[model samples]
Target chain A: MIRTLPCSAAYTNGFRLYMVLFYIFLIMPLVTICILAFNDSNYIALPWNGFSLDWFFANTNERLGLFKDEGLMLSVWTSLETGFFVALFSTIIGTIAALLFEEEQFRMKGFLYFLALAPLVIPGVVLGISILLSSTYAGTYLEENLGMSFEFLGPSFWLVVIGQFSFGATYVMLLVGARLKKFDRVLEEAALSLRATRLEVIWLITIPFLRPAIIGAFIVAFLISFSNFNTTIFLVGSDPTLPVDLYSRIKFSSTPVLNAVSFMIVVFISFAAMISYVINRKKT
Target chain B: MKKNKSSTFFLLMVPVLLWLVLLIVIPHLDMFFRSFRFENDEGLMVFSLNNYLSFFEDKIYWLTFVKTALYSIGVTILAFIVTFPVAFFLTKVVAKKYSSFMVLLLLIPIWIGELVTIYGWMILLSDNGVINNFLMQIGLIDSPIVMLYTNFSMTIGLLYMSMLFMIIPMMSALESLDDSLIEAASDLGASKWTIFRQIIIPYTTPGIASGGIIVFMLVIGDYVAPNILGGKSSLWFTEQIYNKFLATFNWNEGAAFGFLLLLLSSGIIWLALKLTGQKLEKVGS
Candidate 1:
């Protein structure tokens, strides 16, 4: 559309310059961080001494590399573990939600749909704290009245998973629901008319058709759960997830190890993205 | 078959009902109720307006609240302005084959997460950081500029993290736009600015609204960028809520602040939707 616009040479040049600067602004900082991961300096930033792999490999007194940093490693593990469970739960629940919403005669569909998507609008901090507050209240009430302690209600591993999952499922629902909308109901009706059970039809036909979206939603939910901070911080206990751990460290003091971690994440995400992009292109 | 249909409906309903009731409904209602109660001298919980009242009475609280809203709105506008042209260029100016690749580049930062991006900005903006070091090497200045821990840096952090969201929606909107409309208008002697204002803007309003809402909500609720990048005086309202909950252990006040944040942000979004004549359902989708 812009190609059709009647514009002066100056206007075209100005737009080109603006785009150059915009891409620079977008890519420069990330490139800088990755470069600094190999910096020999003690600081996270530059004044580049010669390159060294100390951040990634060293385990000396002062230079503790990310590989050897037990605390950070544990946090990363916690995040992966949490991401797995959150993704699992959110995919199951959210797929069910997508299927439920697709039902033509469902009761109060509009209201229920809104309820499902409500987590998206609510701020993460608000969600985290509200869940934290209510769970604590429930925990205290139960302990006082029924003499049963619910450790999961308090800030703990499971609470963090639950907190992240609250919003994660919403995303999954939207993703899967979009794909579900394009599904041909005629195929299902044909299978049903031939005396196939509803369960068998859903399993053999519907699930297979929705496979791409289900896989995509699962990966997306995992990524969201892993990188989430605002909500996770409030619900995390002594065992902090990677983002929470990174937050406290960045706030108080930071080292080049952080750059190492960032560099690895960049590589991982870019690899995953390219693979998906290739797969998607092939599908088309 | 009738029993199977009912059972299937019930089977699906169980998980959705459990999730909505346990996670969404009860928690928020409990927080709302907690916000209204306070402990008296007898250490017993009683109803009071103290939490909400204190928000008005306290200068810093209400001031921070207003500042957060204004800054978030400013960032949203800035994000839109900065990304619109990029979106336009990608969708229209650039060749179709390469534009998708360009968009993939855009998605990398978003997938890399906020902490990594914030850390990247810190490396750029900090004293003795890359920019300053390069400047000093060229004999530009004697002293390093105090760019980090300032409102400028904080705003940059916020904008950098969120601008991609704006571009994506705008691109999708612009993608669906018919090119001949613009060509016809131009051929009919419509000025470029007039064509843009009359044709492009009206067509892309839905995308702009959705993107604006997202960026606004993100900036307003953001804790990492403000705390990590902003100076002491650049206290965001989320920080106030954080202090109330974790720092001071004042859950009631924190809950009140939380609700206020939710209400104010939602109210602003609602007004924007009203003014734009977009429905919540459509914008939300």
Candidate 2:
């Protein structure tokens, strides 16, 4: 919370020093990388040689190599696809969960809210391993007795999405729940009294009102899925997500190209975030 | 109108509630069940305390739990130190014009993935890395410092990864506070430190506790930062759980480890809620 005490100009100036150090510590490394993206040398560190675009443009074949690396590209696509589905599913589901819990007459509201939010508290790594163990156990049981072979029963892309879906949806629930606390039910009642069908009222009235929050929840879920490494690492199929792919590279043979990749990722994400922020701003 | 409304609401809720029960509630029960099954010639399914006991019986396994808790607390404190002042300046101290840009700068790190953040720290903290080379060139040290793959680096990694999580809630809370309260305190003759101690800290305690707890929870359960940055010495409980499921295929032991973390975090949260009664939800508005 803001300090509610009046301070002399000098004391305020003194506090400014800490803010400067915080910025320096947090921002300097990123600036270093941004600058090093233009490095002419093989290394991705300081003492820059002449400024050059060769590292950026001459890396076309390497980019193709990264694509030809089937596992990496596959995982990247899988992550993108998973992120989209998770975002879409979680936004719709979580919003509904939020609205359900927001109403006055729901019984065991606190406990239901707790259940909805518990996955967010649980760690991703633990969640991932738990999902894997349980799924494999079920898969084995089905194969032995039930006379069934199930692709979805093991650690595949589907299981990964399910694992992600469990907690990612919880995040969406909490976010939408928070926003729903202030939702005015009177508007719905007003629309309904005018003889609008329930479906018509929800479609023409409620969805538009909740649009910003639904979008916000989707963006958050998408970001979580895209960048998720801990859970995805264990549950990954023959392919891994982008984070997992990068992890293997860093562990094995790291080139400055990884830095190049990171730089490109920053560009892509920054543009997306800016667009989302602008939309969010306009909405508010 | 009411009858139709209830029906439509139920219709809207069907997929979400069904999904939650099938995926979350059931899987949680499965996690608890997996923790109890024992390993033997029969291959799984014997109720036992051996899984929990093994955490202590095997030094490496439970020790990681202790190490992870300590690491989480350490990183939480470090992040609070870095973020609180920045948030305070943004909310209370800085002029309105500059704070937005500074806040954006603070948020930029978040655009980078957590794994990428770890890599960024790894590059800076490597032996011939950015920070080491910079120090050496100024003749600060004759030899480049060995900074990689240590507990120190692990703390740094967690702090960097956790900063945004800590900052967002804290700033939001701080923004809601009335700036005039601080002016009143000063006008009534309280010193800056006195106002901070008596009013500011008390007002912000919820933010500190919530942000701190969230950071601790995320840090304690993290596997990537330790795996990449802690290289050798970073023994985290989540890693232990990872090994149990994947490496050794000991689901029971891993499940036990997961439950242990759950207990640890739950206990901390219980204490936090115990101390901060109605205080946290008040800060939201």
Question: How is the predicted docking of candidate 2 categorized under the CAPRI scheme?
Answer: acceptable
Candidate 1 docking classification: medium
Q: In model 1, which regions exceed 4 Å deviation?
A: A4-7, B1-5
Question: What TM-score should be assigned to candidate 1?
Answer: 0.97
lDDT of 2 by residue, B72-140 (tens): 877888888778777777877667766665676666677677877787788788887788888888989
Best DockQ among the predictions, by candidate number: 1
Evaluated on the second chain alone, the candidates' TM-scores are 0.96, 0.92
Can you write out model 1's per-residue Cα lDDT over A47-106, one digit (the tens) per residue? 789989999999998999999999999999999999999999999999989998885456
TM-scores for candidates 1 onward, in order: 0.97, 0.91
Error of 1 at B220 (Å): 0.8
Q: Which stretches of candidate 2 lie over 4 Å from their true place?
A: A1-10, A37-71, A276-284, B1-5, B41-44, B278-285
Deviation (Å) of B91 in candidate 2:
1.0
